[model samples]
Target: MSPPKTYLITGTTSGMGLALVKHLLSQSQNVIATGRDIVSRFPREIVAAHEENLRLLELDITADVDTLQEIAREAWGLFPGGVDVLFNNAGMSAVKACEEASEEYIQQIYTVNLFGPMRLTTAFLPLLRQKTTTTTASSTVIAFTSSSAAWTPLPFMAHYASSKAALSAYLESLAKEVNPPPFRISVVGFECGGCVTNLGQPRQHKQQQQPQSGGSGGLLAKQQEEKTVYGDGLGKLVGMFTRDAMAYMPGDADKMARAMVGVIERVGKQGGGKVPVRLVLGSDAWESVKQKVEETQQVLEEWKEVSWGTDREGVRGGAEGDYLRAVSIL
Candidate 1:
């Protein structure tokens, strides 16, 4: 009999990662869950019960390359056989405009959203390759937790959106490069439209700094800009933010887990064939994706003539200009 397929998931302490981990384990699949605060912040009972299958590895995806490599070595040592699926589920979000956002803020977001996942995936590729080569596996899948925001541009989230967009492009290109038998890349952009997750929490650094209102012109200028730009939308965004502030789901976590498991099993059965690279988890997410696609298509169709540059051809090299050019040359 074949052995149970193994999975290595990052950011397993909360949100979709936690949900995915729980669901995979319930199916009796072996999962190695990594998180920044695996030992301290996580619930004791949860980790204690799943100790056999769940190896708590301390990993901050945003850490330096050397540190990440060390963590990867430790993880590989613990799971020598390698994982069938590597879910890059850890990420972060920023809520400020691109211009207003600090360089540090943008860097932090990219560090977690793009570089961290890329590093982790790169580290695990050898092990994944080994599994495919030795077992004649159909394909090994690497899934990423991308956002709906990746597709649709959103106000005050240029940095977050840009990072996901870059990651998406990178994954798409990487999949093409690694096209070989039993070795495949599957990127799942988990468009969690308004699901409950702790992604809305205020930035830790911002809270620590706590902007003082004392006669600082810069502070007032920022406040004024925020008021002008955010105004009514701020309230709505905040409400949605509060809703997804934790991993808890209004819908059953198990059901969501089942959906993910089904997708993974389907991919496995198909022998590593490409599945829908984008999976909209909830109804809201589906609606949003659909609307955005439709809107984009409409805009493209509307501007097709101008975008194609056919309309400007006559204006650029018409009879009058052709006549002038011919005379001038003579």
Candidate 2:
């Protein structure tokens, strides 16, 4: 049999992260699982029994830029064969009115969801390049756990949705540019639905530096502009997310983990064949994706004449087709 693949996954403490790690280990695969605290997440018995196949490390995704790079390097050293997949799975959730959330809190959520994950991905590229150079097998994967909220931005979870949406957009473009004609490196956005996880519960939010009352047209101005549009606010969302509601969310964390692992396994099976840029999991998420597509199509159709109106003579649709034919990504 071929050598077991090495996986470096973040946020392995609870919810989807923990579940995925558990599933990987059950197959006797080598896993480098990271959390803010190792002992809190992994059982002592499991760690002891699987010590040879497992490596536990403390990695805070929201740490300073240098700290993230340091831990990533350390993680690389932990697996000499090189990382087959980098699962950017760590994230936190805050439930508050969008304006009520301080600028610092918004920055924090984006750090964990977007910037930090990108840093880790870039840090590991050299190692991934080394793997592809040596093996010439399927491309190395960088799969991030984006949310369906990205496609359908909610009122209460505006910041979270924005962060996830931006993350997905970045990965979509990055996947195309990671390497040119000679190589194919897969970048996947594993868009998970509402899984039963600690993500729904509130975490400590860092205090925003600006005084709540005094801020003039900077952050407050942006907040006011948004509030004007979302004036209806999140009353219904708040009511829907009672404690029991959170506990009764439709997504099962374990099942979601298995689904993610299945994506990785299928990609590996390809041995460098085509892998999808995005996989929208869960029935709710699938429906949400469909809704977005339908609505986008409707809007495009309504504006098609206006859209074409801006175009010069004969090159309306042909321009885009010509560009794609030049690149040939399709």
Candidate 3:
């Protein structure tokens, strides 16, 4: 059997984060679960049973960069060695039309979903690298719970989709800079499907409730909106996420968490094999991404002439050539 791995996961108060903590513990892996109030908030049963393997830390991903670095230092001291995996799983979603999304709302979404994770990743890299450099037999991985919304747009989710898309793109760029030997940091993003978690809860819940469940973060929706052109359409959108309605969604949080764990373990075993750039979970996520890819291909084929016409004729040159050559692509 593969040996237990140390995982430091963020946003562990509930939803995908909590489920992942439960799943990893069941596998006898060492887990450093973090959230806003993880010590008192983590389930007592699991904590008591796995006291030797589990450690709880209070981490608010949206904190300032310096605070995040301090927390990373504290987390580094919890376990005996380097963290085997760092799951940047904390995220929040906003549900509003482009016109109705307040600047504050938009900023909150970006802070929690994109900027926060980026800062945390920066804070934790030194520790992850330390582990990799010292243990030639081990590999360190960083994973994100990115969403299928990144590729498949959904109504009332512009901010959410855009933020996730930006995060995924950033990870692609980061992988290129960090995946070298001596510090073999593997970066992956999972484009997960919708699941029955607090993530779909309306804005009221976000303001009124405490974090305690398995969800990316509670869904965001204003309780009241001034009359607007969207009218009935907006009403229908809000109605679709009522607690009863969300319960009917096909994806299961536990199942999604289990799938994520399985994929991470499988790839970790591959050693130097090419790490997956993005992985989609759930049947719905699969279909949505597949359709998006097909549509993108069609658009590219039809726009091929316009695309090529914009570029200068003959071989690439100037700064572009210099960049390509510097990167060894030419």
Candidate 4:
């Protein structure tokens, strides 16, 4: 008999995470769900309905290492053998200029979006590393819910964008670290585009309050100064992108969640499993990322000579002919 497939997801309280939980449970797969204040807001009836396969554990992701260790112990008890996937779906955003973000707010964003996932992933290493390679199950995947904003830098939400960019780079390095034989773990990043979720709005509602659950720091939106050098232009650009562009975004949260599950299923199929490190979802995400790549490449090419000249003679236009495949200014 095939081993029961189990998925562990964080930030399961709302939005894509909530949708993902329902979708996985409906498929008769075992799911371990976690988030802050699980009892107060979550509907426990759903877990009761799927008692055998669903387990709910409340976790404060921004908590200390001891707290994370406790949560990992609880999670292991639920699935003692191992976990098939660790979906790091939790993230936070702050609608403020980089300079406008407080030390507290920046720390909060990185804590939930970046550090929290790292802590949990590290804590679950034993269970994750126990994944068997011979099985038909796809390579054990540790996925992160990244943002398209990572590619396109916006003036207001610089922290969120940079955090995600760092996440992608970190995951890429992790992919190289864990793959190619003995270690079967695979790292995949989901660059989810705008969906119909209250992701950025709550930060606005709880601006005055201390940073807590999914603190978006929307309160800082008020800091956009119309008189600042590029203030008006930045405001219009951000407004049009966030409001007008999102108004017509094609992807739905639930649908995206389902599609993600489908992709996971394909990982260890009959054909050798293939999990692309970066999965960019939605038409809007594809277009925006593509534009950013093109723009960057164009800028790089325009300054190729000056940029490449910094390399020592042996490294650049060296006698050994450009230190192997080292790029040179034509």
Q: Which one is best on lDDT?
A: 3
lDDT of 1 by residue, 100-207 (tens): 677788887788789988888787777666666677665367877776666765666688778877887766656555544555544454544444455533335422
How many pairs of residues collide in each model?
A: 5, 1, 6, 0
Please give the range of 10 consecutive residues that has the lowest summed lDDT in model 3: 205-214
> Which candidate achieves the best TM-score against the true structure?
3
Q: Evaluate all candidate structures by whole-model CA lDDT and list the values in order.
A: 0.63, 0.70, 0.76, 0.71
Q: Which pairs, if any, clash in model 3?
A: 14-213, 14-214, 14-215, 15-213, 15-214, 15-215
TM-score, every prediction: 0.77, 0.83, 0.86, 0.83
Clashing pairs in 2: 138-272
**Model 2 CA deviation exceeding 4 Å by range:** 137-139, 179-181, 202-232, 243-248, 268-273, 312-318, 322-330
Across 83-135, the per-residue lDDT of candidate 2 in tens digits comes to 78898887765545765888888887788788878888877777677677667
TM-score of model 3 vs. true structure:
0.86
lDDT string for model 4 (1-330, tens) is 666678888877777788888999999888888877665555677877998998888877777877887787778778645578888887777566666577988887888778887888777766566565545445477888887777876677788888888887777777776755666787778887766654553332322222222222232334344345657666775666556554445667878888788887777567846668788887878899999989999999999889888887765353465544332211
Which ranges in model 3 have alpha carbons more than 4 Å from their true place?
201-229, 236-248, 270-274, 313-330
Clashes of 4: 0
- RMSD (CA, Å), candidate 1 to true, equals 10.3
In the range 81-174, model 3's lDDT, one tens digit per residue, is: 7578889987777557888878888987888789989999999988788777777745578889888889986787789899989998888778
